[model samples]
Target: DAGVTQSPTHLIKTRGQQVTLRCSPKSGHDTVSWYQQALGQGPQFIFQYYEEEERQRGNFPDRFSGHQFPNYSSELNVNALLLGDSALYLCASSDLGTGGWAYGYTFGSGTRLTVV
Candidate 1:
């Protein structure tokens, strides 16, 4: 399988607006991760809802939030958008049973968000 999928291939929003993005994990993967990629740079971690209450996050502010459902799918929400928020939103899935990223994450092309 592709491992992950994201919606709204491209998005445009005004500053201060809110946005919600969706993701579906790869089969048998119980962990979902989100990342933000800016121009000419690698993706920056946003957050991850893993097995149990083990949650990992990056330096993002409260404006970013995420959730993982029983089905292992997830949603990423961003509030009070800023021009700096414009970038590619990436989703990755991994099987923690075999040591999460130890097995490498399967990622999608990502959703492009442009905050005006």
Candidate 2:
């Protein structure tokens, strides 16, 4: 895991683009979390990987997996890429080891994935 490192700060139009992202926990953080932000909505929690294993998950399919931190990138797989999947995917990291995981989260930029 190299943390959440998003590329193409702009938008990535998709006509069948590889809908897979990457992420990892921060250096001191042991929990890697992922989020999905639609065009006009707040980021939604997808899942979290802690201790190299998935610990918690949200109302998302198996495709949404990864972490977000100052620098991170996880993998979110959307088998059936839908137009609704087109949104900003973000990665975040938290210090779950110190019991301050949900409170303090560091988020990196976002990768705008457009499904067309």
Candidate 3:
């Protein structure tokens, strides 16, 4: 009955450094997705994973990468971090092919990354 979980609730990194965020999906979930939300802005899709493969991606740079594990856990990695990269990184999990209002994704509290 646990929801999605993200590690390292907060992080600080210097510009040009790299960072990795971790996530564990909700029970019975198979798909995992990542999003970035800046202050005063809504969440922006980063990418999605299904069957341990990336199924979809948004307009993020190549520096952004992700991986999904067999157990439905996932990881998000950012390289050459910039000040603009500072934001709340969210991980959402849901069952694929179960699209509808009643089967919405469950999101984690998110990892706050600050690039100084």
Better of 1 and 2 by TM-score: 1
> What lDDT tens digits, residue by residue, belong to model 2 across residues 20-48?
66555456665667788997799998878
The sequence of per-residue lDDT tens digits that candidate 3 reaches over residues 36-116 is: 999999999999999999999999999999999999999999999999999999999998857712588899999999999
How many pairs collide in each candidate, listed in order? 0, 16, 0
Ranking by TM-score: 3, 1, 2
Which scores greater on lDDT, model 1 or model 3? 3
Q: How accurate is candidate 2 locally (lDDT)?
A: 0.67
lDDT of 1 by residue, 1-116 (tens): 56588897999999999999999888999998899999999999999888533389899999998878888889999999999999999999999888999989999779999999
Say which candidate scores most in TM-score: 3
Residue pairs in candidate 1 whose N, alpha carbon or C atoms collide under 3 angstroms:
none
Global CA lDDT computed for model 1: 0.90
Candidate 3 Cα errors over 4 Å, as ranges: 100-102
Query: Which number leads on lDDT?
Result: 3
Which RMSD values do the candidates have, in order? 1.3, 4.2, 1.4
